[model samples]
Target: MNAIAAPAAADDNGLETGLNATLREPISADGTPVLGKTYTVPARHGRAVRVKAGQTIRIANPHGTQVCDTWIFNAEHLNEFLSFEHTRAYIDRIIPQPGDPLVTNHRRPIAELVADTSPGVHDTLMAACDLYRYRNLGVEGYHDNCADNLRLALKAIGLRTREVPQPFNLWMNIPVKPDYSVEWLPPVSKAGDYVDIKAAIDCVVVMSACPQDIIPINALNPLDVEFTVLDPAVSSHS
Candidate 1:
């Protein structure tokens, strides 16, 4: 029989690695939002909202410089989430275009990129920033980070994910160089630019206005972003 190595001592519980305001506020008790109302994800904070199948979520870059770290999870099964690796393979591109299907770890379409008002420049390669990342940057005390924001956001809405998957970094530019290196650059999107993601299945969408002041990303000034859930029926009925 083969021997299995025991895991190292660590905080493995699916809870917030640390705390922040993201734990206090949820768009709603269960992460539900008004059908057509816009909600703000404050700078250095995160928010989660539920999107039903056939509904679309429009995330706006009011400042254009703010980077939004995004994630989508199947409402029924947290383990099934939008997987960038699978999505990149599914779409045959690292950056998904407006028409591309956002695929999940199960190799199924969980959401579709319905519209993109800005230049198609988003990142799928970088892990969401964490407390350790801040520590490495010489930040003392607690720092608000996307990884913890994700955890606390979900926890705020009575949900938890065992793993923190790589997020779809919306409006986050990391251009690849000729030598295969990448540069973290500011977003090219302009104010009012937005992307609309339509749910292929019932899912929860989370957004973190990345708090990375140490880097050029977010233009070194993290700011708030907004989102709204658009119900197709409303437009159709009106």
Candidate 2:
């Protein structure tokens, strides 16, 4: 599948800029409330929604430094498509410096590293935070994380959580150093800068606005995020 590269101007120094806002919706803690086709993502967390080909999903880091890891999967086949290993391999193979298109396992374009909105880019090598990782990180008491949200999203679609893999973290900044070491940095996204994706196929997109307060990533405070869908005509051209 042909992938359109997200322009470097869009994501200057991992900072969100030049994003035009069209709509805003609130996500509650219980879950994303249904508002027609729009989904509300609660504060300090994330959610996933299904989008058909030709549809577009727009996510905003309503509160800066809100890290959201996303994943796209074929709704029909469900077993194949965006694989984390493949995505990492692709990124490693190309060694994208900045402003590169991230491809899925099927070679389908998933997302472009359009805007970083942070001084440090999040790790593509590190998987999503799970119970195991949380415990290892000395935050065993924390039960809720991006992994839990993904599991819930899978259940919402009548799919098993185990079937899902680690998702791509959007807006989160974990920069790689010259020595190839990774470090988590504070978010560079402001109140409104958003990351937009146009679907290439009928797929389920999942995200978790990271709730980890132990680090500086969220400024030690979790805040709400917004999700919206734009008309194809507008989103594609805008």
Candidate 3:
């Protein structure tokens, strides 16, 4: 097993730190209400990020029910990235322990379940919400969401649109039954509780604070979330 270490504090450069006060952004229910202080992350699933080794990113769910789909890619090589299939297989192989590490197909540690404050487990099978799904699900008007967020993140990083893949839904509640069936329900994340993870390799962390009101994932009122970067004490190699 890969050794885990405590997250380090950030210096003046915002390199290593707990939650940076200056970096926090407020998300509002009405998208237009957000002024200069807010970073509008349109709903787009399958967002990806490439954080360098030894950097930790914190995704703050300021509002309770927001769903953030996330994925990470190595800064050096995007091909060897997080595989949802591998992650699901790993989870199935394990005993469903609370804090087990989710390893990637390359046998590299992807992210750790540092905290699961919610009762419902996130969905690995659920595809990122898209325009087509919205139309098919009877919520066609709200076509753009986390999927758009992913596209924006990719564009910011200079990656083509086709590179984005299926992501891990952060706060979305996808319940699995003993009979192997699944149901989508209200999200379980509370304000301030976040899914924290230290990158195993130099990778970018992409996320979309979901904006879907038709579903209860955002409690019928989608709110905003905050993202902060923390510094790691040990190198990725160590």
Q: Which of the two, 1 or 2, has more TM-score?
A: 1
lDDT of 3 by residue, 173-235 (tens): 777789988777887767766655666676656677665667677777766666555444431
lDDT of 2 at 41: 64
Residue-level lDDT of model 2, residues 54-166, one tens digit each, is 56667777666677767777666656546657766766642233455556767666554443333434445556665556577785344455655565555544543334465
Worst 10 residues of 3 by lDDT: 13-22
C-alpha TM-score for every candidate: 0.93, 0.71, 0.69
Q: How would you order the candidates by lDDT, starting with the best?
A: 1, 2, 3
Question: Any runs in candidate 1 off by more than 4 Å, and if so which?
Answer: 1-13, 234-238
Ranked by lDDT, the better of candidates 1 and 3 is 1
Query: Which candidate comes out best when scored by lDDT?
Result: 1
lDDT of each: 0.89, 0.56, 0.55
| Candidate 1 per-residue lDDT over residues 1-238, each given as its tens digit | 1112222355553555567788888999999998989999999999999999989999999999999999999999999999998999999999999889999999999999989999989999999998778888997767788988898899999999888998999999999999999999899999989999999999999999999999999999999999999866663311
Task: Name model 3 segments beyond 4 Å from true.
Answer: 1-50, 93-99, 116-120, 139-142, 161-164, 232-238
Error of 2 at 185 (Å): 1.2
How far residue 156's Cα lies from its native spot in candidate 3, in Å, is 1.7
TM-score comparison, 2 vs 3, better candidate: 2
Query: Whose TM-score is greatest here?
Result: 1
Model 2 segments more than 4 A misplaced: 1-38, 88-101, 110-123, 140-142, 233-237
